[model samples]
Target: MSTITTIGFDADDTLWQNEQFFRQTEKHFATLLAEHAGGHDIEARLLEAERRNLAHYGFGIKGFTLSMIETALELSGGKVPPNVIREILDVGREMLSHPVETLPHVRETLEELAGAYRLVLITKGDLFDQERKLAQSGLGELFDAVEIVSDKTAATYQRIFTCHGDGPGRSMMVGNSLKSDVVPAIQAGGWGVYVPHDLTWVLEHADEPTAAPRFRRLEHLGELSALIERLGREG
Candidate 1:
């Protein structure tokens, strides 16, 4: 039998439609600053602001909105009108209120695996916003436990897997971001399955670990069940 006892999943773009909304909002943001800056320049400055503010604001819609406002103020020489800021806030609110659309094969795949292994929803972001998304997803009950963390690191996976299952050695993490989900989970001595999403955020990008024995990649979640079965048989 396979030694793996727990299966962890990343939320955001992994399980549902997330980054697309952010992308859409970014386009709108650029439009709002059309007179002040070009789209490429605005995008670059916004990314810079986001990177700088991550330590203070953390993640999710609130942080993103703050970064957008900061970029607008800076790009517009501190003359960005109040109405623009108000529109930014409105877009942020729209993101928070947007319906959770689970990705293809997510539900059925989770259903297939849930009966055979412990499932944990491990994701990082604004606590309230993450909670809202999870509740809206209708996939909450599928998870044996839910961890909405400030970040994902090797230590984070080690602690979570140990607390929720046998240990990291016997756990697997599936997600879209190699930076936050795959690399750290593998470094924690667990299997890291990469499921690439077309709309993954730029900051979440990382080089793939193709030679790692515990690393795996899938074209989509629909392939996960067969991969797990193959692993089980390999043992």
Candidate 2:
């Protein structure tokens, strides 16, 4: 086994619950749209709106707002009320103001890892929202590099490797998201360590946990030191 060097992290649900808030807000928005937008099916419209927004706004609250507006107009058959936009924007901004609570053992694990490996945050979302969370978390200095992306795919990880000049031998990814953190990180030639969260989104699921040497997992960040020690001893 190769000794790991750089350690990458995923933001959002990995650090603290993020998707739950989005899910909540979406439900609220859907209800509002149903009433105001004239009986439009909330779930279907939301999916359509998200698909359209992904193409137009990429990812972020700005695009979300746009999608809300588009959905209202389309569903209402051009009967969108002015206040509808305000309501959605208010929700989006509220998302910005959402409380910042770090995950359990996150700080301690980070403190430990900081001494052993170069830390970087690689997350995908609206640039503005992601940046705000990063700033508010007060975790900026802990990460040697910070990457805000629109999406994380197999290609995204490899690109991150190139961007940061980190090869598999010297790099690892420790995060809660398996889809975004585990598979892509390994496919990109970096080791991945998953930390399962009590509350997590469904989108990050993987078919199965990646196997040893290339992949590892911990229930909490507290176990990180031991995992690293085991890997080190094997190497």
Candidate 3:
């Protein structure tokens, strides 16, 4: 196997605290509409709304905000007050303005690997929002390049790996989501290292790779440097 020369990282949930904010916002939203629907019912409807709106609004806080509003309107039988709508918007604004909290060992791991490989950030979300987060994240300087894409797929990984590194086998993708980060990169012939997060968005959930040689799982980002070193040596 070709030696892994390029490293791609997923931003949200992987490098920083992301899903927790969404969960908190969801909790706040549920409380706002508790009269219209129970917590479970409201959460289910909001998730469905988010899924349906993905193609239309794409991904990001803006889309999530709209989905929450839509879910509120639907559950309230179009009777949701303007003040409630304003509160929902406020939730989104707060999320956008929230500080980017780096995950444990994220900065240190990136720093350790930065000089040895071409580090790339492969994240899917709103461009402006991603950019803002990157700016706020002190770890931005570690990434050689940043790609804020609309989505993650095998084709996308193939193109990115091919451009930045020798090819798929020579590149590795590290992330928290199996759906968006690991599976697609592995399918594209790149090695994928899964670093599980405490919380994951339901939409980004996917089954684990059963028996892939190039797929490895770790408990956290702190263990990533060792995994990469082992992979490099084994190759």
Candidate 4:
């Protein structure tokens, strides 16, 4: 069965817990707001601002910070005290400059799997931020190809697999989300494996598939290499 030659992976929550960091930052923001703002107005404003800004600016610390600033300006009605706005900006900047803390088993598993497989990383986010995380996590060196996509759909998966090769069923996709990672790959005629994430954003959570049965869920990345090896052997 040795059909698979390339294995695709989704970054962020799949490789590491991305949503946890943001959630931590959000907590800090809420704390800052409660201290400076009248009540929880800062928190509320930030939420509303995020909802509004998801369009103009996608994900990443930069967009998040910009939204925080926008929220501050609006909440203050242009009368925002300098200290309050500065505090928000400072927090946002800190998040941007923060180091990447990858989830457990990420580095070790990649080290083991990269040797036998053609690894590819497929992530969706602000190009710069995604690249920064990749570089920082030290996982970038393992992948033969790195793709920072704006979106992942069934069509997108087809294009990727076709470009890689059509004959070898050796290609597999591993990720955290059911919607973007599993369904798309399965629909594209490939294996779709899910590694459940402890923390992920609302947007990252995807709707269940309506058609083909292309979903395999795993608790951790450590279990993936064996599955891939078995598939490789079977093929």
TM-score against native, each model: 0.98, 0.86, 0.98, 0.83
Q: Model 3, residue 233: what's the lDDT?
A: 87
RMSD, one per candidate, in order:
1.0, 2.7, 0.8, 3.1
> Number of clashing residue pairs in every model?
0, 1, 0, 8
Return the lDDT, model 2, position 24: 84
lDDT of each: 0.94, 0.76, 0.92, 0.76
Per-residue lDDT over 1-235 for candidate 2, one digit per residue giving the tens place of the 0 to 100 score = 6667777888876776676777788788877776654334765676677776686678666776677778778877887677877888899888888987777777777888885677889987778788888888878888878999878876777777666745755677778877778877787777888888766554457764545448887878788888888878988
Clashing pairs in 4: 1-235, 2-235, 3-168, 3-169, 3-170, 4-169, 4-170, 4-171
Better lDDT candidate (1, 2): 1
lDDT score for candidate 2 against the true structure:
0.76
Please give, for residues 92-171, the per-residue lDDT of candidate 3 as tens digits: 99998999988899888999999799999999999988998889998889988888899999999999988877788799
- lDDT string for model 1 (100-146, tens) is 99999999999999868999999999999899999999999889999
Over 4 Å off in model 3, which ranges?
none
Candidate 4 Cα misplacement greater than 4 A, ranges: 35-45, 165-170, 207-211, 233-235
Task: Please say which candidate is ahead in TM-score: 1 or 4.
Answer: 1
Residue by residue across 154-196, what tens digits does model 4's lDDT show? 7777777667545225478888888788887887778888888
**How would you order the candidates by TM-score, starting with the best?**
1, 3, 2, 4
